[model samples]
Target: MYSGQSIAITGAGGGIGRAMAEKFLAQGAKVAISDINTELVEKTAAEIGATAFTCDVASEEAITAFIQGAEAANGPVDVFVSNAGVGFPDEPGGHAAGGSNESWELSWQINVMSSVYASRALIPGWKKRGQEGVKGRFVIVASAAGLLAQVYSGSYTTTKHAAVGFAEYMAIMHKADGIKVHCVCPQYVKTNMTKGMTEIKEGPGKHLEASDVADSLFAAIEKDEFLVLPHPVIKDYFQAKAADPDNYIGGMAYRAKTIDKGHIPLQ
Candidate 1:
């Protein structure tokens, strides 16, 4: 579905964003790549012959301008990937329960509201063009944490859940208009965000690469699947949780405690 189409990807400077940008370019798509890091975005854009834009996804004005800039450069965007995010490690004094309002607000802005801002700016154009059914795609990179709470990162978990929910709503509201929405839920990937997590042991096929996730996303887009789970185990986990919520939460808590055994808390 993405062949020779124009696509816009936020957070295209690093990790999953960069991986997706490379994969799309490889698939013969004209890509408009945006990131807060202008230098990296420009470098990647130059490398792949993509149009680059510098814009913080958290800023509504920036997102709007980016949409206009991308359209000016490569016509109306056929696919929009909302993938920018940040992580805050768990802190002492119950970080997951009720801590760090600032962190929560920032997470909400980038992880959750960025999708909203992008959809708002682009959906109107999509409606006017009446191009919903003809290979249009909106892909949001949510997380496995969206399906299940992360032990230490309350804000990340909450916002990821919101991102997935928003994607569902968009799909429901715009399906008749031909817009396709997809949410990607991936487990722990080896990225700068999880660089220091010694406890996260790499099991067989456990740690997915960013490029792996990106490839799954592209496949999902072609299939028009709403949920793109790079880590297929997550779908099983999700079903198990849905079948028995309390038991699932209990099991996760037990596993977390086991993982933290004998470790000194970060000072």
Candidate 2:
């Protein structure tokens, strides 16, 4: 389904973004990948046969510039993946909202508004294409934290919820405009964001490689699905969350007590 189409992804210097870019390239798509790290993105592009653009997704101007550059290099984008993300642990405080204002602000910019800015830039053209029967896809690499919680990171959890909410908003408001939205909510993936985190080996949850996450996305696309869950168990958890809010809260309360054991982010 991806052959000869233009695919653009953010945070493609490594991890899930890079894996997604590789998958698109293998499917005969002309891919454009971007990251805030210029050297790293350029190197990844050279190695993976994708066009490179350095973009700080936190900035609206930078995002638009990246889009224009990608279109110039590989035609109009058929799929735009807002895969770039960041995580910030809560500060050492007694309350749940311990993260600094700067951390919360940065988290909001990167995790939520980045997707909004990209959608604002792409939806106009996508609507025109949709009217002609060609639809465009928008993918957001959110976290299971959005549906549940990230324990130590209030900023990460809150902004991810916003990210997921934005995806829903786009799906509801712009589906008629030829916009297809997919929200990816994975539990724990082996990415730089999860570096040095102990891998889960037992139970319903497990650590996944970045490529595994990309494969899940392809599967969702094939099935014409909206929610791309790399970790299937997340769906069960989400359903349970909706089923019983009290038990879910108590369970998370207990999990928070031990999150530092192996769930603490290295960075």
Candidate 3:
């Protein structure tokens, strides 16, 4: 589906970012992998024969430079994936427990503002093309926690929600300009972010693999789906929450208490 395209992927060093990069490269797309970890990014780039650049997505200058470099090397960026993110540490007084200001601010910058910066930098360039053969595309890898309240992480949930909201706004505003915006909200995937989480085995509510999530993203892009949910259960959960906000919150609170009891041992 992404044949003959030049794509730029942030956070391409590990986890879902690396999986998505491999998938895109296998489909005959030239990719530029960007990440803050220069060594890992370069290693992945060499392994996949893709261009590599060091970019801190939270920084406007870094993102702008990376985009310019990618365009210069691989022609116009047909697809841009804003996928860099950080998880709040599991601590009593951290963002996960809603205590520290630093953790919350840092999470907001990386998880939420990074997407905003990428869109701000690239949308103008995309618009300048003016009704091209194929529209430029942007995808934000949000989390299912965005749509549903998370058990502990306040910063992660809040920032991811903002990311999804921004993606929706971008889609609504730029659809007429031939810009395709998509938000990927996946549940617990087997990634570094969820490495130490308590595994839940309730039917299909179990953890999803990174490659599976990446495959879902490819399908979503092919269909031009706005919300790409790797975990189908999350859709039902979202609907249930939307149907009855009060009941949903009450249920979530109950579940949170249960999860907390289990998490105490892990901590």
Candidate 4:
């Protein structure tokens, strides 16, 4: 479906980002894949036959360089995926703890500001072309934790929520300009991000392969959908929460208590 298109993806060294690169390449798109880790980026690019760049998405200057480099390597980017993110150690008092500051800052920079930096770099050029009715796709790989919440990490949850909101704002404001903005929200995908975490077989979640999430993403792109829910259960959970915030909070509190029994450090 993506034949002959030029695509750029951040955090493409492993996990969902790598899966996305593989998927797009399989569909015959020219792909430029990047990661903060130079070795992983080079390895994944070699493996997938994609152009590689080592980029720190947390830095706006680095993001601009990556985008410019990708466009130079391939062509005008048809799709740009802001998929880089970080999960930090949990804070017992959320943002109130002293140690939480570092995690919070990192989470905000990577999980949230990365999307903004990508948008800032893309939107102006997109608008110039979009005014002529040309289409450009911006994909943000946010987490389902944005819609509900991550019980273990306050920084993660807060930044993901910001990511979702920013994507929505872009979609609403720029759709008429022929810019397609999408947010992919998935839960429990098997990725480096979820390494060392125990899988929950029951409850409001289930684990999925990174490729499964990639498949959902491609499907959403095909449909030009704004919100991509790789785990359909997340939609149900989101609706339930929207329908009754108090009830949702009560249930989440119970789950949090159950998951964090003994109130020990979960890192």
Candidate 5:
């Protein structure tokens, strides 16, 4: 179904973004990828046969430029994946708001505003396409942290929640405008962001590989679904959270009590 479609993905130098790009390319789609690291992104493009651009997704102008360049290279984007994100460690003091203002602001920019900018740039074209009965797809690679919470990363969790909210807003307001929105909420993945973190070896919440995430996304797309849960168990957890907030908080707090701030792998 993706054959000849124009696909654009952010943070594609490696990890989940690269996996998404590879999956789409293998499906015969014309793919364009961007990352903040020019050298790394260029190398990834060369290796994967995708058009490459360097973009700091924290900047709106950069996002607009990336989208325009992607369209120029591969026609208008049929699917645009906002996959770039940032994570910050809360200070070792165990305070909820221990992160610096800069970290929180950066998180807000990259995790929340980047999607807004991309959507702003894509919506007009998407609307135009809608008039022709074609729908544009927008994917947000948010975290299960958005729905629940990431214990030590205050900024990441908050901003990711905002990301999910904005995705919901867009989906609610633009369904008739030929826009399809998908939000990915996974527990943990084997990305650079979690490179030094502990990976659960067995049972539920086991850390996933990048390709596993890409596979989940494709499965969601095929099913015309909204939430892409790479870790299916996250659904149960989310339901449990909704069912009993007090119990969920108690359980989370107990589980996190022993986690030292020094151990968190800040991305």
Candidate 6:
């Protein structure tokens, strides 16, 4: 689907990002991949026949450099994937629970502000090009936590919500401008992020692979859809949450109390 396009993905060193890079390459796209880790980024890029750039999406300067370098190496990026995110699972105090301010700030920067940075940099160019019949795409790799909520990690849930909101705003505000926006909300995937996470408990669907998410993402992009729910069950869960928030919150609390080792209180 991405044939003859220039695609750039942040956090492409491993997991979903790497899977996306591989998928796009197989579809004949010029892929530019970046990650905070220089070694992994180089390795993934080489393995996938993509351009490699070391980038920390948490920093605006780094993001700018990555975009510039990727464009130079490939071409003007037709699609930019803001797929980098971070979370601390077992921290004592996190999000609202008295976690250190630094952790919260990091989560905000990586999970939320990274997409913001991409929009800030790309929207103007995309708008100008869109006026001339050229369109650009932005994809956000958010979590299902963005739609419902997570029990143990406050930072992940809160920042993912922000990410989803930002993606929605971008899509709603720019559809007329020919700028396509997609937000990917997936349940637990067997990625590095959920490596040691055992609180997952019994879920409707089993853990997904990174490739599964990449496939779902491109399918949504092809249809110009705003939201990509890889697990499919998340769509129903999200609708349930929207239909009755109080009942949804109560159910979530019950699940957390029953399955989460964090011992998070309902109050």
Which lDDT tens digits does candidate 3 get at residues 132-219?
Answer: 5557899999888789976677777788899899999999999988999889998777777766667665666677778898899989
Question: Compared with the true structure, what per-residue lDDT tens digits does model 6 show for residues 1-267?
Answer: 578889999999999999998999999999999999999999888887999998999999999989889888888889999998887553653335665678789999999999999888888887777335448999999988899887877877888999999999999999889888889998877778776555344566667889999999988877768899998899998889999999999998888668756333211
lDDT of each candidate versus the true structure:
0.83, 0.91, 0.84, 0.86, 0.92, 0.85
The candidates, ranked best first by lDDT, are 5, 2, 4, 6, 3, 1
User: Residue 267 in candidate 4 has what lDDT?
Assistant: 46
Clashes of 3: 0
Off by over 4 Å in 2: 130-134
Regarding lDDT, does 1 or 4 come out ahead? 4
Worst lDDT window (10 residues) for model 1? 258-267
RMSD of each candidate?
Answer: 2.7, 1.3, 2.4, 2.5, 1.4, 3.2
For candidate 2, give the lDDT of residue 260: 59
lDDT score of residue 90 within candidate 4 = 74
What TM-score, over all chains together, does every model reach?
Answer: 0.92, 0.97, 0.93, 0.93, 0.96, 0.92
lDDT of 3 at 130: 62
Worst 10 residues of 4 by lDDT: 258-267
Tell me the lDDT of model 1 at 62. Answer: 98
- Per-prediction tally of clashes: 2, 0, 0, 0, 0, 1
Residue-level lDDT of model 2, residues 1-267, one tens digit each, is 799999999999999999999999999999999999999999999999999999999999999999999999999999999999999887765478877899899999999999999998999888877336448899999999889988888888899999999999899998777678999998888888888888886766888889999999999988978999998989999999999999999999998886655677626
Q: Cα lDDT for residue 227, model 6? A: 94
Model 5: lDDT equals 0.92
Error of 4 at 170 (Å): 0.3
